[model samples]
Target: MIAKKILNDTFLIRNAKVEDAIQMEYVQSRCYPTLHESEILDRNHFANHIKVFPEGQIVVEKDGIIVASASSFRCDFPEHDSTFLEETDNLWITNVQIPNGDWMYGIDMGVLPEYRGLGLSKEMYKARNEVCAALGLKGQIIAGMTIGYGKVKDQMTIEEYCKKVMNNEIIDPTITPQRSAGFRWIRPLYNYINDPESGFGSILMYKPVDENYYL
Candidate 1:
């Protein structure tokens, strides 16, 4: 377990266990209220993820309460765009993960509303990066939610909004944080998930393990 104390509270970040499934599900539901029920991870899915790739699932707890979690798998970077369900194989992950894949595919990451500003997610990201380094994977890739887009979606195109976010003209609750965490935008994906708030759009982003990783 990775333990730290912040603001007089203790936080623990560690690889998830089967027993943590229920709390993980709870955290997921709380973090993604805008997502459709089918798109959110459930207790059974969390259990399956840990069973399939024990080291790829992680969770954060504060004062003994689960507050955040992330799920990931190994895969080769794809050449074509795909929906979130297709990329994650309907969240089963077993069929899509490549044991010897070149990249770490970040399936999802979430921090409860009350824990959002505490940098718990950042610690989780660090833990995942350590996993990538240990496995010799090239880096991490993900389809990030354009969460703030939902508020102004009818006023502009998804592409235009993404561009604005990219250029710092706008700050997306999701994409902006991802950029701060070192992800580079590749493009926008449509019909990525059932998130009306994001206008059903997601951003394809990548973070190389190192500057020389591609070389």
Candidate 2:
């Protein structure tokens, strides 16, 4: 996709282009540490994922260089699950994660070091919502981060996990244009919260898009 500059802008979140690979790699490297490269992701993997699944990967550029990226894609798995990469359905999706259901999925929200706190990440969500609505999708979803049960347990008693998941350190799905667009919020309690395989601070939230929010 050709990059469209936004309003003589300070930032532009546009469709991903083949040419943006280098800058995209640069951002991914900076946002994550070396240790994260094993469990999380690295630059080459990121570029290849976008090339293979362009539906949801987008870049936020300053001038001609990409400084951030956001992923939002659709699938038929049903319910909100973030580790869709764990799916054994298709060979093509082996490396890349494929979220379940006919929904707008968020792989992640990344920004360059200097680009943090500029609301560029949020703008990237707005952009994702726009695409979801246009595509006639029912909802938007993301595997949100949770602060870790161990950390929370440190703050409170074991009995507090349930209440805390809802009242406190939980990932809320309806926190964007998805909320304003009337998408339903679905929070599923999976082993991710208490399992060693799961990363700390990870939960899935889905928001269904309305018929008229962006028409």
| Residue-level lDDT for 31 in candidate 1 | 87
Q: Per-prediction TM-score, please?
A: 0.94, 0.68
Q: Write the per-residue lDDT of candidate 1 for residues 38-149, one digit (tens) a residue.
A: 8899999899999888878898887678889999988998889888889988988989989899888998998999888878777777788878888888888889999899
lDDT of 2: 0.55
Off by over 4 Å in 1: 1-9
Tens-digit lDDT string for candidate 2 (1-215): 32455535777778876566677767766764422333444455556656666767789877667888865446653443444344212213434444444566565567887877666766776677667766666656665443344445556543354345555455333233333433333564344322332233354555555645331
- Model 2 TM-score is 0.68
Give the top-scoring candidate (TM-score): 1
lDDT of each candidate versus the true structure: 0.86, 0.55
